[model samples]
Target chain A: MVSLILSTAVRYIFPLQLLFSIFLLLRGHNEPGGGFVGGLVVAAAFSLVALANNVWTAQRTMGVNPRVLIGVGLLAAAVSGLQALIAGQPFMTAAWIARDIPVLGKVGTPLLFDFGVYLVVIGVTLTIIFTLMEE
Target chain B: MMQVNTVMNIWIVLPILIPLLTAVGAVLAWNWRRVQRVLSVIGSAALLGAGLKLLLTVWTDGILALQIGSWPAPFGITLAADLFSAIMVVLAGLLAVTVTLYSLASMDMERESFGYYPILHILLMGVCGAFLSGDIFNLYVWFEVLLIASFVLLTLGGERAQLEGAIKYVTLNLMASALFLAGVGVLYGIAGTLNMADLAVQLAKMEHPEIVTAVSMLFLIAFGIKAAVFPLFFWLPASYHTPPVAVSAIFSGLLTKVGVYALFRVFTLLFVHNIRYTHTMILIIAGFTMVTGVLGAVAQTEFRRLLSFHIVSQIGYLLMGLGLYHPAAMAAAVFFMVHVVLAKSTLFLVSGVVHWLQGTYDLKKLGGLYASAPGLALLFLIPALSLAGIPPLPGFFAKLALVGAGLQLGQYVISAVALAVSILTLFSMIKIWNEAFWKPQPLAATCASAQPVLLIIPIVLLALVILGIGFFAGPLFTLAARAAEQLSDPAGYIQAVLGGA
Candidate 1:
């Protein structure tokens, strides 16, 4: 049976974990935090739900197929490289919008690439975890 | 003028770009299996066209290098194609198109829906990436990409046999990757550069040449495992026959060759300081690899398993050329690579058909394609005889080149071994012909008269490609000669990549 105290604590912890993961993703371009660590944090939060609740509820909370996430992440990374190819330069040349965007600083392809990495990390890790747990 | 540069540069990387987008296209269209099939085939066709263009560009313009992200040489990742790499890309594209088409008709519905096509394209992308990568670290990354994809493809069906095969395949290959990465790490520490060209320059000038020689063994073992050479080859025959026919066919055609390619690339580019020890060691390994592989083939009763053993044997001939370490020997290796890919894949595809028709690959349970299906027998014989190196076939000419080079260099023992190996190879091939084709009908009336159009098309296409190589031996030899010449002189490659640095 699910422990009431653990379930209640996870409910409060999950939202904060997601917020921290996002913070990691945002800071990834320059600082130590990036998509990989950020994704792991989110995956850990979801796993806690599976421990305190159940896998079905965790899947419901995520509300997206892991395979689809992989596809989208790969698409984002490849397209970021392709945009440079289209712009008559070598592939993956970082191009910036030339303006600082609020808290995210100047936006560019590298940041997009980091976000793609974030998505793939989450997709692959959860795919492994879910498959093993189910087994 | 700038537009012209962009257009030319675009051709150099299209082999990789097309497949990456193709995989992404297949993945994103996950909900629609029909769309995925059409997309995969079309993507493969496009890759074939791009491969041809890339080959043509490399033919006329010479070695082309792209500094990705416009980073300077020895710093940024680079994608480059010389004549040899371009040819391999073309071969990869050709195999991709054939296998993708074959899978459309033969792949199970479960594997189809579970992301098969996407993963297949990703494997192609990794193969092309490995062929085109100019940086050593980038090469390792591409190897992992392809290896990971191969692992997933091998286990797609989740059959007990597939799972068993995949576990061995995964463990051995992961060890190879660890060795490869460790080699990379140590090389970087010594040479302080990840660019292959830059490393060649620095490695050549090192004060203690013996340390570099010691380090070369790491690559030999690492690549030897991938190439399935000598002691490192058991993983291949153990796991290769376990996959679906389409998967086996492509793996037979291209996967081990990637390992061989890395061996050729690394030895010629960076580790030429002491040819006496290193290349000679390869020569010894090549000889044993040939003997063991053919002997294993002689003992196999199953069709696919026999073919897997032969892949290892065929690699021996390629290595014989490398072991000889002359320009003509290298040229011979290049020619043999192209010839064997077509021949081996054709044989595998024919075996797929045999299994499909009779519902078994066991020779004891099989017989009489000769009586019921003369055309299929002919298809099988063309590649079988070619593989056995009969006259006027691609295999004969390829063998002649290697043996001739071996004799020319006075490496008489290896040349003699090469000849003896071919005889054994012929004996094993004949065993298959007798058991599977020439023997009397085992099932009698159950032998169907017709084969599926989809299955026959690829086997016939590849066999005809084998025949084509036999017919146009002169031009193929010329291209291989040019590639070998480029490999013979690392200075041109180093200059082209480093560009006045």
Candidate 2:
């Protein structure tokens, strides 16, 4: 019963951490934190959830397997790189936008690449932890 | 400036994206083996198609660049494909298809239940991303992606050897990563921009000889560790042999080449002005790498271990070409990279078949497989000979190109060492043939069902590719030459990246 209450509180914290990770990634371009660190933060959150719940249960709740997360992350990152090609620039040349929107107006591929970073960290960390847990 | 946009731009991204999406689908379908198989096959096929299409596009266009979010050069992340990157993508795609097919046939269904295809796809994505990325820092990110996937795959089975190997692999690679970051940091501090083309322009303007040497050395060490160059390669043979054949095949084919690609990129573009210092170091390293690597191979008793050692030795040949810094030498490196990928992967696949039949990779315990699996033996023989640089095989032409270039550059010692290494390579192949195929079947040899046709198909296909490159050397050599020329002349590459004519 106590475990159930703790699990509920942990679940509430998870989304908050994920949001913070995204914030870190977005603000990383000129700041100390970036996609790689932000991704690790997200992975750490998922890892905590896995530790609290069973690996299988946490995996199910993830809605996608860790490996797939890695794949998607890689895809997202590659697509971010491709954005340069589409604009007739060289490979991995960074592109951006600085528009005035109410909320997140100045979003760009760097942030997209950061999202990819988040996915990879989560996928890789979970894969290592879960695979070890199985052993 | 005139702009030309084509569907080929989409093709450039698909090789990386398809596997990534399929990996996700595989995980979601983890409970359903049939769905996983279908998704992997479809994804791999799509990647294959994309790779071929991109190759054709690059052949015609000279180089293709894609700007993310419609951002212009020097400011945006780009995925650019020159002839070299395009060919690497095609090679990787083909290898992925074959390895996936082999995995489908070879992997135990029960053990593979936990999203194996997903991991495979992600690994392929990392490789494809590394190949297509145009920025130095972006390349580092992709390297991490590839390394992490490979780490998972290495430890997938959770065996003691796998765990041990994974630890070493991860530890060594992590060190490489740290070094890579340090190198990037130094380069960034020196040049201001992390994009390869932009760095090239900035580096061209810097006239400080000491700073240039220091930065190049840093890059050399970082890429050297990844490429498994001499003194940094002890971890490779130990770890590579622990994985399943499909995993080993892909790792052997794609992983080290990423390092080679980085070396080729940096040396030809950013550090071209200081060829005397950098190229001379490359020459010495290449010589030691060749001598020690082949010597390590000669000492190995296990098939996979021996092959892993050869991987190091072969890297020497690639670096040798880079050391020469001649157009012909660079062409030779390109040709050799393709040849090594095909030959090494084929050899690993054949070893897989042998292990499947005999349940051992030890030379002493194996014999007489030729009678039971003549087809498998023949499949192994072609790539073995190709790797040994036998005449009429692509490996021979690759070696010939390097040697010819070395001779022209008057690096007689390097040319001579190249020939000596070829002889040693042949000796190593003979050792395998003698122990695994030509020797009498041990009385303890256990028989298994006729070799799985799926596994053999990919091995045979790769062997045929080796032969095809050998037969059609003229056009491919010309292509490689063009790539070398383009890489050597960084003006176009820089212009494309910096949005300047």
Task: State the DockQ, from 0 to 1, for candidate 1.
Answer: 0.71
A30-66 per-residue lDDT for model 1 (tens digits) = 7899988998998899889888988888888989977
Which candidate number maximizes DockQ? 1
C-alpha lDDT values of all predictions: 0.90, 0.85
Off by over 4 Å in 2: A1-135, B1-3
lDDT of 2 by residue, B429-490 (tens): 99999998888867676667577789888988888888899899999999899988888788
State the displacement of the C-alpha of residue A9, model 1, in Å, after optimal TM-score superposition. 1.8
Give the lDDT of residue B62 in candidate 1: 83
lDDT of 2 by residue, A54-123 (tens): 6677677778768767768867877786687666654455677777445554577877887788788888
Question: What docking grade applies to model 2?
Answer: acceptable
Interface RMSD for each of the candidates: 1.3, 5.4
